[model samples]
Target: MYLDYFPYPSLRLHQDRMLDAVYDTVSSGDHGIIMIDAPTGTGKTSSISAALAARPGKIVVAVRTVSQIDIYIDEISRIWSKTRHKPEIAYMVGKQKICPLEREFRGESVYAGCARLREWSRNYVSSRIAKGSSSIYDPASDSMPEEEPGYRTFCPHYLKSREGFELNGAVHFRRSGRALDVVESLKKRPISPSQLAESCQGICPYEIMSLYAKDADIVIMNYSHLFSPDFQDIIFQWLEMDSEKVTLIIDEAHNLGDAVRDMNSRILSMRMIDLAETEVEKFEGTLGQARLDESRERASWRREGIRIIRLLLPRLKKFLESKQQRMAEGEALLDADLFRSFIYADLDDIEEALSNFSDVAVAVADLNLAEGDRENLQGEIQPSLALVLLFLNDIERAEKDDSYQSKIAVSGSGGKRQARLEVNNIDPAANIRRITDNINATIMLSGTFSPLEAYELYLLGVENRAKKLSLPNPFPRENRLILGTRKATTQLEVREDADNREEISGHIRSLIE
Candidate 1:
């Protein structure tokens, strides 16, 4: 079956082994995490496809982003065009990103030559949707693309025990054959809001991952989605159920730790707290008798959170300044940029102060979730908290690292308003272990897992049942060259002189050319 679908001549020995390993791990029913270190040009995608063919349960292949997902999906469709077995693939992206223009294109409504209008359609849609304007939406309802009348594209591939899990390609809607201009299309075939939505099946990364990805073969999302608490519930759910049975690939593994750090951190900012107060004020006149008092209390708490941070930041800044002055005289003992190296030192305290403010702001914003702002609160608070907490936690933890000891400080009095310094050494082992205990298997793969042994040790925290393999670069070595240069090397030092500097510059330019 693979022979017929695969356009390539044959799978290499290592590719076959990788495929078999993945299949065998799934068959064992004990989640397996295999890190295949196949370098670029080694038919990595082909090997992955073959593995999917072997055990086609509800597949969820995640790329780092939606665009990459589109590229891979298109490539797969083109490759599988002649095959008898083809998987039903769906594309999901963020709701914010799926502009109205793109929806029109998918629906085959936006006329050609008006590319500019197509681009702006998303902004139009956002505005209309925000305003609850039904007039503009009415046109979409009038024109509904009829479902295709043909035998659905069905994949012959099947897992041994999964009888009902069939890849039904017909579930997806194809765009219309006709492309019409805005005026003509609107005249001939008005589309309804429901039809527009149906034709536009795009959902955001979180939406796809959390709600729409039940039986998805591939889920395209950001790195943050996998590690962040906002999305960790879903990530854990997937891992806990069949993680060992899954192939969890981190496309950009270099940023994985940073992403994890980002996911873990939280911030509380003055602006955020202020925004909450503003939003809560807007709801003052509309809330119900039942929830009015609770809403008011929440608003007050948000205000209190903001006040605490505002008072804390000025003191934190003065402390850091004093430390900086004291340290300036001790250059032999410490590098000038030692404190400035970490986030806490570099981000003028205002930034960290604002970031921390954002954290409390999130809680404050949540308080504004009165009966009037219910919908806004429902959709916004979680993401806001997720975003703010990441910064807050990062700032607090980064502050704790003894390497940046000069940056640490404490101010403000006790009683729900004290400012205490928080620090983090970020134990990769402990963190990885926590994730591993939650999932079946953890695979950390990247092109440059520098100090590969170090990475292996790091993964040891989560990858107790995993096997690691490294492959050489698949490209010709001669094609890739490495060169190193330093800013202060080779060239003669040019003093801020009149004649000698110009002569040196000309010589450097000649050498460059």
Candidate 2:
């Protein structure tokens, strides 16, 4: 039924079966999760054609990396050109990549700087609209207003994007303006994030792409776009569609488990602690020079908070050092209780102390952005204090959960030795389910899902509910070679034996010859 949407004039071997499996699972009334293990030559991208043909609501194809997005774009372009079936398509990349001010910010400060600029731009545009002036600020013709005394800078692209939009309560785009024209143009073709960023010379690329994604039939995004809770919220809000109405297609699904675990894990390193100390000291040095009485009071409170954090950092470092001394140059399970007790011992009220430190961290981040310090902007600035708080918070949350394992890893040797606290996620099933359970239907495609049952049960946690399809190799037997041997074994126990090593080496040599 969906063959009309397929790009090619004819389907390759086993392609129809793969496409039928996707169609059946998605078009079914109930929510479904299907894992497809299509071999390398099976034309896996065509699964997108099957999804489109299903007419599933708002198909979202999430790839492992930004580079992988191009494959889908090429396939969709083919569908449009050959079949004349043009579905509205939009793709998103991380803000850091598409931010117009990326060159100006120079480092990890770009995100903080972007946030600061957007806040300023929103306030500036609001004031202008209130004063009966044009909300849109033209960069080419109109000179930018001087920066407000306290504010460092404004983003003209962001300001321009605010045009014809109601921001009083909920953001509602006005349909009868140049914004509509831009949306229509974007819908005409699948534009990559870089091309979108370039075409949006005066408007915010992120904002425009988000707007395009809202009405798009298909949105291509990164894995983080769906798995990271914070980003997931933003993308869902932009789509303006219920999760139950969204059909998710995860490309290269083999990476999902690792990606989810990495997302859930928290790491606290000595380098982070040192940077947090620098931020606190720098912010504290500027405290007494502030103006208003209210401002002074706030500064005084922030100073007290930083003082507590300053005292806490050394203790935390000592804890990590002590753990390092106990372990060899490798990882060992950590006692969450021991770490928790150490933290509690330092503060009378653990929650209050954490809250104070969090407030101070925010203030320091703002101060650093305002100052635009050359040293701070040179690298990604993760407030070490924040990392400490997050690690502690994760430990608290994982107290009863066996899926999370707290560990300390010692790396390098003697003088160069480094130890870090980690709350590792051993099982990503719960996290993955949180997503798959809510969506209408999910179709996961990968070339490496050989033990498909393992992914169905462990990684996705969709055991009984999921549909599994493993397509045979499309290439003919004579055209390809497959070989195996039991003579050489690389098992840890026997691999080091002289005969075993020589046999393994001989196998490799024979294959090469």
Candidate 3:
């Protein structure tokens, strides 16, 4: 196979084994995990593709990012171009993640794309306006400018073509133009599509994996899709394909824990709760018309719940703030597991109050109120309340299911904090054993299943244990020196040093010189 299509030159032994294991599992009618623990520089992609030749149904080689996807696609296309066995390949990502221009040009809804483009354009225009530039309002309606339109204004096909597109026909240039020109134009006008795809909910990165998990021979996607409870359900649905036919290969496995945590966590900031309260309060004073008798006690409960949320928000903020401080000072005061507990606790409290508030809000909505009081409603509060209720419901479902675990946490830096969660309660060992019991044969491989024993530790309790094998690096060992550095700067210290502008500048100068 012409594997040189890979951006990297050669495949590593572990990658080869993983690919071989994929084929072996399919042939033997069993499923297994291939733990690839290799440092960077191993040609994992080449090895995976090479091994897939033995047994191929629908092949999906999932990776973390689109760039990685691109590299894989390019390599696969090149190899399949020369090989006899070629599977149909299609690339899909989340609707929001893909370029709006591509979506619209491809006949997908411009609503999301347009919304995003408009938001971007608004920011750009607002920024320009702040800098005292009104030229943003001025457009060259007479002719297409030599300069390409901004991404928000540009059409997907135009951007993809790289030769740029024109504002064809009679284009109405807005005095205070919306950010997304394509969306704005489509709003006032319409375009004829060259062709149409099957339903256009406009797939996103995660949705594609969910939709095609079972049918696609070589599935490609993020680790989050397979490991996260919220996402994994979608993947697991597809993994039901005879158990033995599917292989889960995680790239950048080091980040798997963080990804899982993110998929499981939920964060409803104090601002969100405050906004909900403000909106819900619009129904106040009109309780006479509200159908539910607003007893002093019920009103008190609603008021108290709002108060509790207000009080609770500050604590959550304080907790997050303290963690931020500790992080800034370069300390390990918090971890993924601990932060998860905090989120769960906060959600529990929020759910209690929010549910009470929602009941009150619904009661108020049921009551006849003045148009002004009703109009005082905020847009996001109702949805926020509903979303919180939905999350709580999902939590309850997982709690009883016995198949999933819920892990939530507060994580990240000062300005960039994240509330995260991950659910994976099902024992992988039992999972493997059950599948093996059904299928009766298995093989696991990877170029980076290093130290070999580590994989054993990971898959120790797994059922129908397969024979273990270790291959050389498949390249000259002397040609590469594996340097283990002990003095690597800690993540916290690096973050701190990065915050100091002068020090960063000095470091840059030293490096440049």
Candidate 4:
């Protein structure tokens, strides 16, 4: 059965065993987790053949990097050409990579800029429809007014992409024939994000990939698309599929633990505080003009909120400076309560102050965007104040959770010294299990999961529910060479020493000779 979808006419040694294990685990649905520890020559990408043979629904493959995405795309394309088994395939990267407006929206996050442009596009279309001037499908409906600032206010690509789709009250796309044609063209072959962006001249490449993914049998994406909860929610919603119905494949499973830890961590730096202070000062000058239509009482409250942020900035800088003086050039544990107390000493209610700060940060960001001065919008687009709030919020959330550790690290030399506050996640099992427990089945592939029990029990938290398969190197003993050295040590403490370095170089020289 697996051979039906397998791209090559033959499988490598032990490749059949790996394929059968995946097939049985997926088909039986008794065990929802499987770990494949196959060495370099094992033909691991062919595991998709077994997955497709067993499951009839969508398969979401998570890769560690952008380059890994091409292997799957190439394999699937080969499958289509060789076996005549064509499964619709699609891939997505972060919006920041494919968004055309990223350069125009300077310091703004692609996410925020995309949202604003989409809103403007929708409003423009709705207004045109209301006046009976054009329908959603009309080409002219996507055109900007002769007198209006088109690119500044709305994205032409976004408007053109949505020409054939009417958004329901729930925001689901009710696509027409034109939209279907676009999706069909995308399915003619598997395209990388860069290729997709290049081909999509006047339309939003992200949206086009999204539209195709809704109907794709297999979708390839980065690790964050599945591991990060926010990205997971957006991707699943865009695909219009439930977690229970989707089968997930994690490529390079060995790196998952570190990836999860990185995703949950947050950082705040002295430089961010300095930029935020500048943002607040500029925002205060424009507050009067920005809030003219608001009630006097509300405007006064906004002003007070701005003042609080301005005062807090210097205090934050001072705190970091003090910590820098006491600590060496390394990291030290920070007491969450002590940090909170020091930062919030002037506020009567800590929660309310945080809430007010969040509100002011968002207001300042929106005001900066509304001013129509992209050149001066430096950090206002992403708003360092918002980042500060996020860092503090994470510290608060992890206060009682032992799985998280808060630390302050001082780096660089005397004149270039910089201090940063960070909240690090020590355990990744909980986050990993969060996704594994929801999906129909999870197949983790890696070339380095040696001592398989470590990954099965500890890293993946799938001890009882997982079927483990470890394959030996596929190449013959006579065809390969392996060598090692015990004379040289690359340990951090001694690796930089002159004798140790010379010893390592000597070994390399002997090998070359």
Best by lDDT: 4
* Consecutive 10-residue window with the lowest summed lDDT within model 4: 371-380
Which pairs of residues collide in model 2?
none
- Candidate 4 lands at a TM-score of 0.78
Model 3: per-residue lDDT, tens digit, 1-513?
A: 324223344455466555554456545544434444444455555544544554434444545555556665555565556555454444445434543344343332333344344334444444433454233323222232243444336222222111112134222223222223222222221111111121222222222233333444555666444444434444444444443445444454434434444544444444544444554455444433352345776567766555554444455455556554444333232243454365445455645765664565455434421111101101011234433444445555556665445543456676676543333343343333343344323333344466656555444454325545455555576776544434334342363465455555655586569
Work out the TM-score per prediction. 0.52, 0.77, 0.48, 0.78
Candidate 2, residues 422-475: lDDT per residue as tens digits? 888889888888878888889999988879998877786656668899999888
| Whole-model lDDT values for every prediction | 0.42, 0.74, 0.42, 0.75
Model 2 CA deviation exceeding 4 Å by range: 100-109, 116-141, 144-156, 163-180, 274-311, 321-327, 346-386, 413-415, 482-513
Could you tell me the lDDT of residue 326 within candidate 1?
A: 45
Task: Rank candidates, TM-score, best first.
Answer: 4, 2, 1, 3
Error of 4 at 196 (Å): 2.3
130-207, model 4: which lDDT tens digit per residue? 565333545334446543332467777677666533455212224334545777887787776668766665577777
Worst 10 residues of 3 by lDDT: 372-381
Q: Per-residue error at 392 for model 1, in Å?
A: 7.1
RMSD of each: 14.7, 7.6, 13.2, 6.5
